[model samples]
Target: MTVSAGSRTLEVKVLSAEGLTVDRKPVTKNVFVEIRAETLNCSTTSLGVADGARGSPSWNETLMVEIPPYARSITFDVKCKTSMGTKSVGIARIALSDFLGGIVPESSLQFLSYRLRNWEGRRNGIINFSVRVKSAMAPKYEPSVPVPMPALADRGSCGSQMRVPSGEQHNPRGVVTGIPVWWTNHSANP
Candidate 1:
């Protein structure tokens, strides 16, 4: 899928998760992580390693997702499937500043880890992942510089650009007229 306007493409690799537990028991199988960025739609990784030591699930899955313009974080929702149904194991909300902000380059790969929190807001585990920025956008607008209108000296020649001191108006030497000097980009208005 193409990155939409004002959005950035994030290549996120969900490597693995450690110390995950549901009810004081290590999770064994049917483990998956839903990767998303502040939206209902999400990209889910394949089931992690099925080893009995399910406490440490390994996914090693990479997903490309478009982050919205104002999104400053990504979420990893780890889930485990039980006989009853799917259950929330843990969730990690990772900030984008580590990889997207500051001096980080666009194509630089950043491997990082974050602590997960359970549905009840308890310390759960640590999710290891790597993220890279696929693309960057330039700022939309530059700071505007305000220019003052020069006071007209006479009707024939509206001349001289003078700096108006703070808290005081510009007083042309010798004499001053009420004629207003205007500068505009509108073509119709001269």
Candidate 2:
């Protein structure tokens, strides 16, 4: 449950899952990790590096995530691994949920539930990490504003360019232009 800043990416590593139980039974064994990441304006990508020695190792696998151009934030889930004398299994209750909540919006919390269900009876040696991103287009109620008239101006020989005012500006019709009128301290509120 630790996150560090990497070069142009994030290094998220799962410390360990505490108080693990199986079928209403307390179990004790070495538990690994399955990390999943989902963000806005991007698809879910699984991260891992190839290594002969299994288990968990620091610097073994660095979750190098590139910040999406339009992404504001991301969310992820961590599932712990269990061993049964020779078979490694992924228990549903052994998973924990955490998110980097910001301006980004995820698809739904239900998806995490679905992933936990997938490991019901399967004891796969490999830890499964499912990562998904909710694009900025998920919002359906965003209202559009009218383009300002003053923003439009001729560039001489090339073509006419349109500029829109942003925030607020003096308009006789009480219309808030979308173009940015000022970059410094200037309030258009009236």
Choose the strongest candidate by lDDT: 1
Measured by TM-score, the strongest candidate is 1
Q: CA shift at 99, candidate 2, in angstroms? A: 8.7
lDDT of 1 by residue, 13-123 (tens): 988888888899877568899988998879999999854445478888999988887787889999998989999999988777767755776688989998989989999
Mark the 10 consecutive residues where model 1 has the least summed lDDT. Answer: 167-176
User: For candidate 1, what is the total of clashing residue pairs?
Assistant: 0
- Residue 10 lDDT in candidate 2: 36
lDDT of 2 by residue, 1-190 (tens): 2222221233433323333344554334433444333343222223222333332311223344444323343433323334534222343432222332323333332222222222455432323333333232211222344533443233221222233332233221122233444243233332
Stretches of candidate 1 above 4 Å error?
51-55, 146-190
